[model samples]
Target: MTAAAPRPLPEWTASAVSPLDAKLGLELLEVSPERAVGRAPVAGNTQPFGLWHGGASCVLAESLGSLAAHAHALTLDLVAVGVDLNATHHRSAREGWVTGTATALRLGRTLASYEVVLTGDDGQRLCTARLTCSLVPPRR
Candidate 1:
């Protein structure tokens, strides 16, 4: 028998909102099962020292990775929840926006993992992160 065709990626809607994302001013550029891209400004997300907060970088990383994994799970009529996340801060950003890109490392039936990279406006790597998510059936 022929295998079934894969389901298409879900389209993101303006009404689909995340309060934390909105609070952080995250602007999503692209999202799919393969990757997710987004950006957040450093102006308000910085620490008292005026440098970008490492937590902000982790937030961006987790957002991208989680979104990508969720997109992958949707294809199977499932949902994803982050189980573990880790990040390494390499540099700092004092101004402008930091862009984050998350690429899938593994997309499996029960788990998904993604590598997320955060870069400054000048393309300098600011942080590297990895997120692992568990996929399960959505609550009825």
Candidate 2:
């Protein structure tokens, strides 16, 4: 049998998919599980006040969990869409790019849920997020 073709992920789904990381100045990285092994830097995603913005943390969390959901759906050729998302900031990163990792709590046929935790360079908690996505039939 021939090898299966590599699947296509959304621009938001792939690693380093940004067309202008330099312009955005984000050294984005993606990792799975929340055990602290999977954390990506935020680079320039900080507020002018010198602390990590809530939106920035949200993006990082969403990116990771969505990736997991999509990858999970790929097994069945399903398309995943984020239906609901939530985040709780436990602390702040005053300097340096923060890293956030996601852990999957549920991966079902119709929905997948993941939890993301962000930490500062000093290894302090910055934020925590939860994302839920719906897996639907893929378009032909």
Candidate 3:
């Protein structure tokens, strides 16, 4: 992650979860220093109703925000935990991978906030999510 670039949240880390848990195959492709950008296939992320699930969006949002917060605490040796999150479904995603961009709204010493927008293959908004993370202090 470049200092000038945005950062990725902690939950985006490969170490945080197993491949099986990445049902949507959300790949954390870019961490610009304070933002997390990723992509996940619609097929795996969608629900039985054939649209992307709201919970899936929330998972992505929380992951991105948490990862960014964790990165922020690296200097002090800590992690991050999701405290609050909200997701608004704008449209359904049915046939392709969706791009998600997580932008940090706040990155404080004890807490962090991020807004994640998931766009369909055609670049239409599928969901808008916001998340907060509480920095976990290191164990002494």
Clashes of each: 0, 0, 14
TM-score of each: 0.90, 0.74, 0.82
lDDT (Cα, tens digit) per residue for candidate 3, span 64-122: 66666677667556777788888888888778887888898888878878888989889
lDDT of each: 0.90, 0.68, 0.75
Mind giving the per-residue lDDT tens digits that candidate 2 earns over 18-71? 443333344434333221123444546667786677887777677667767777
Q: After superposition, how far is residue 56 of candidate 2 from its true place, in Å?
A: 0.3
**lDDT for predicted candidate 1 compared with the true structure:** 0.90
What residue runs in model 1 are displaced by over 4 Å at the alpha carbon? 1-10, 13-16
Candidate 1 TM-score, C-alpha based: 0.90
Ranking by lDDT: 1, 3, 2
Q: After superposition, how far is residue 140 of candidate 2 from its true place, in Å?
A: 3.3
**Residue 64's lDDT in candidate 2:** 66
| Residue 116 alpha-carbon offset, candidate 2, angstroms | 0.7
